[model samples]
Structure formats: C-alpha cells, structure tokens
Target: MALFFFLTAQSQNKDLPDVGIIPKIVVKAIGVNTDIQGIIKNDSNLFKTLSSELIIISNMGAKNASKAEQKDNFSIAPDEVKIVATKNINVADTDNIIVLFLIYEDEKLIARDRKELRRQKNDPNVSDGLEIKGLVVENVRSKVGKDFYDYFYQQFTLKNPESDQLVKVEEQLGIGIGTRIQIKVQEDLVFESFARPNEEQLVNLANSAVARVLQYFKQKERQKQLLRQF
Candidate 1:
C-alpha cells in the first residue's frame, strides 16, 4: 500500500497551477440546481502565471449518469486567483460531482481538480469529509536508510514546503540481490542510487536525489511553457 501525505497549494504536481471545481448545490422544493465555476490559482512564488490561452474545461455530472461540460479561456497572474468557466446545471439531486480540467495550449493537460456536490436531507450538520495527501515515504529501514530518508525529507521540505508534490523514497530489498533506492516525484523516478553504499556515500546520494527531484519538476515547468509557445 502507498503511504499518503499532503502539501497544500496545488495539484499532485508542483509544476502546474491549481484548477479547482467549486460547485454550489441548491435544493429546491421540486428539484436541485448546481452552479459550478473553475477557480484557477497561480502561486507566483513557486510557479509562473497562466496567460489567456489557458483553457478550463468544467464537467458536471449527477448520480443519474448525465454529464454536462463547459469550456472557456482564462488568464491569472502570479499570486492571484481567478474564476474561469461558469456552468449552471439543473441537476436531478444533490448527488453530483464537478471535475475541472486545465488544458494547456489545447493539447497538453497541465492540471485538474474535483469536488463533490452533495447534501444530506434533514441533516444540517452533515459534512462532506475530504482527505488530501502529500509526500510519501516507502520501506525505509536501518540506520543507514534512516539517515538517507531524513536527509531527503529535510531537503525536499525546504525546497517545496507548500506544494502538493508527491514524493516517494522507495527501498527494494531481497535475498542475495543489491538493495535499491528510488526517489520519485509525481510518479517519475528522479534518482535511483545507493544500493549499500557507505554512510557518507548515502548522504551524497540523498543530496543528488533531492537535486534531481527539484530539477525534474523544474524541467516539467519549462516543458509546459514551451508547449504553450508553439
């Protein structure tokens, strides 16, 4: 099983900005009406701003399996939030969900977020419990391994403390085979090193791993921007 941790601010990737689907469900005497909007956020401190070419695709669905979608373009400055796509649907009930997608340059998918629209009848205190996760560590053992884990944690935390970046330090062990360490960011392996190296070597490996992780994310950011230019 994969472990879960949460770095708030954006999607599972720190490379792209955040696009959230905010749905307000109103219960009428006859049926229900849902108003959903896409809230795009850009953290200039961590990422670049999204210009007018950014497209937000909003999808609204109900328990009856009916789906509706809206698309629009938007621009948001760094350290700013703007509402993009607005979709109002007459849903059958409060059992609904909104999925907002950010398509960069119409070809690449940069980011997306989802929210459930629900209401409990006659229960005003019902809460829609949502769980979010960030930064995961896997199968770390022994003092050597612990040292590596600690170092990677400190370095990554300092680099991206407020990003929803999923980080994993996976350890592979078996009989007669060399152990393996793979540090991954957003499901992409950034560094795979240090089977059974010495303590000093392990520290160095951690340093490389952290640097590779950051470099990988930085490269992703640049790649998306290049896609936008052409």
Candidate 2:
C-alpha cells in the first residue's frame, strides 16, 4: 500500500500547478458610496472563504472640490475635485459604507440651447449666473474585488508544489500544509472630469479609473510570479 501510494503521489505531483508560496496581495476598492461599499460587503463571504486573503485596505472615501481653477487659456480645472476622505474600514461585516468622492472640478456649466443664453449673456462672468457642474458619482466595488479574486486564484493554481501522493496523503492525514498568502492595498481618488460640450468625458474618466485598478492587479501578479521562481 505504501509503495502504491508513493507511485500515485509522484504522478499527481507532476500534474499540480507549479504554484509556490501564495503571494500576498493588497485589496483596495475605490469609489463613492454604493459602488465601493456594496461590492465589498457583498463579497464578504468570498473573502472569508480564501484562507490567506488579507484586506489591507477597504472603504476609502474622498471629498469632491466644489470650485473651479483656470489653467491655460484653453483648459479649466473643475471647481469640485474629489479627494480621499479616510482610511479603510477595520471591523468585519460592516455594511453600506458611505464614501464621498470628488466627481467634478471647476468648469463652466453650459446649456444646450440659447433659451437661457440671454440671461447669461449680460452676466457671463457672474458667479450666481453660472450653472452648477453636476456631481459625478461612481462605484468601483466589483472591479477591485474581482481583480483580487482572479489574481489570487491564478497564483494559487500556478506556483504551488505538485505531488499526487502527497496530496492524497495530506488529505488522509487531515493536515493543512499549503501555500501562504498575503494582501496589501492603497486607495486614491483620481480626477477624471472634463468641462466640454458632452457627457462622454465623464464616462471616459470613470472607465480610466477602473482600468487603473486592473493595471495595479496585473503588476502585482507579475511581481508574485517573479518571486515564486526564486
């Protein structure tokens, strides 16, 4: 039986993913209100399921500025800019996290037609006459969460020691000996607003924010892979 088990273990080891020590990661969710809070709380179960998962940072908030700044003749910084408000949530099972973020900066709010143009024509520079730039809100919960999960999953299956007999023996022994995992995160509110003739700018900015989060994950994955080779 021992010999039979040894042979089986050697064969199984060959098929196991070459994953080494599970890489540590920093999980961070960026956005205002529902987008950030809802996703983290919703995936609380998944976090618990992953044995080595560490939520280094979560529920970061930012404040939006409500004033405008004039730069070069062609460009204007939105009056209201979003800035990070606070640190990550510490307690577990906290729900409905409310995080305020800057959605816009200083820029002139304009109307589509001339109906209101006459009123502003006489007082183009009037502060009261100027329109308020709409508030920009975004949710970034799912993007951050999924990125962390996928990266962890890939690392787990890729660098760990492979041994069929060892796996079976470990199962029979009922001992837990596997890869170690860690996580860390840094959250920041980035500006993605435009004072233009269309709404496409805001959409593009939000997309950019999500892409940044994905890029962060990919970079970390590469680091982990390099570490495993040593």
Candidate 3:
C-alpha cells in the first residue's frame, strides 16, 4: 500500500481575491492476490475493514499558512488510489512541502512502500468549503443483553475514511446492537446520530454523518457571511 497527498490552489474569480484550494490523496494497493474488488462489492463497511487490516501512517508539513482536508468520495482499484486532499491545507513557498506515507498490510505482515511528496506553494486563504474533522463510532450496545456485545462491537466500530484519527469508545448497556456517530471539528461536535448496528445500517450511518458535517459547515459559512454584512 502506497499513498500520496497533494495540496494546491487556484483562483476561481479574477475580480475577487478568493482562491479555490483543492487537495488530493492518492493511494496504490499492490499484492499478489489482493481482493480489492471483492471488498468493494461484498462488504459495505470497506473503510472499517481496511482500517482493521491495514494501518496507514501519514504526516504532512506546510510552510504556507493553510489547512489540509480530505475528500468524502473514496474509490480504489488495483492500479491506484486517488482522493481529494484539502481546501484549507496550505503549502509553504521556498520550502519543500512534505507528506510522508507508510502502508502496512495485516495478515500478510509485509511492509509495502513509503513515499514522501514535495508540493509547490499555492494560495491558502480561499475556502475549499470542506471542513470535516473526522467520523467516529461510539456508545456501542446490545439491546438484547451483554452476551453479544463483543460480536456487535466488532461490527460497529468504523474508521473515518477522510482522516486517520481515532478516539476512545466506551461500552454501554442497550436493548439492542446499535451505535451513535459523533462528527467533530477538533473537540466540537458538528453532527450526531444513532442507528442499529448492521451492514446496511452502518452504511446509512456513515453517509448521514458525512452529510451532517457538510451541512454544518455550509450553515456556518452562511452565518459568517451574514455577519460580515454588518
């Protein structure tokens, strides 16, 4: 597994100083018999499963005043992996911006590859319009009883596809298997939802969580714009 992250920006309107910044995350999976397609088609919890099987080590540095972002859309093929990077992430001028990637595949226990990227400086002030801190699964419980808690816990925990950040989750008593997702920007909550713990439900949970995050930022930006008029 190998991945790269790129941060760049461009002007959308010539009249205004507003810039459009877009960052990209690219990944490539290589193996003799890697079941990439099967995972995508069969398992609905792709991100969660992958996170369990592989540990992605990533780091970024920017000389420019900017923030990096990850896109919501994710797809993978045997050939390569590509993803939208950031709207706020800035790369510094006169210095080589670096993003290091280290991928490890579980079960196989093979260290695949490591990559370091140097990106050019670009405008960072403009809004990329994406502000999703991360997604997390929490408050796992079994409605029936504690007997099936471990089984459901294994199914409910999910990885935030947009970012590699994990927070602690606590066990709670419940009448059935279910989880609540809390999307956050730093420590502030942007969105939250509770749902049954199943494959289809898990899918809905992730999509709904992402939608809330996006909507929260959109409304926040609107409020900021309204205040600027004053």
**Highest TM-score model number:** 1
Model 1 spans with C-alpha error above 4 angstroms: 1-134, 161-163, 174-178
Model 1 steric clash pairs: 5-133, 5-134, 6-133, 6-134
Looking at model 3, report the run of 10 residues with the lowest lDDT sum: 31-40
Tell me which of candidates 1 and 2 scores higher on TM-score: 1
Per model, how many backbone clashes are there? 4, 35, 14
TM values, all candidates: 0.39, 0.20, 0.34
Task: Quote model 2's TM-score.
Answer: 0.20
- Candidate 2 residue 2 Cα shift, in angstroms, is 46
Candidate 3: tens digits of C-alpha lDDT, residues 1-230: 22222333222224332111111222222211111110111122233212112222223343343333221323433322222122223222213233322122232221121223333224363222222223233454444223222222222222223343332233443345454444454456765555554645554554555555556556767887999999
Q: Would you list the rank order by lDDT, best first? A: 1, 3, 2
TM-score of 1: 0.39
Model 2's lDDT to the true fold? Answer: 0.24
Minimum summed lDDT over a 10-residue window in model 2 is located at 1-10
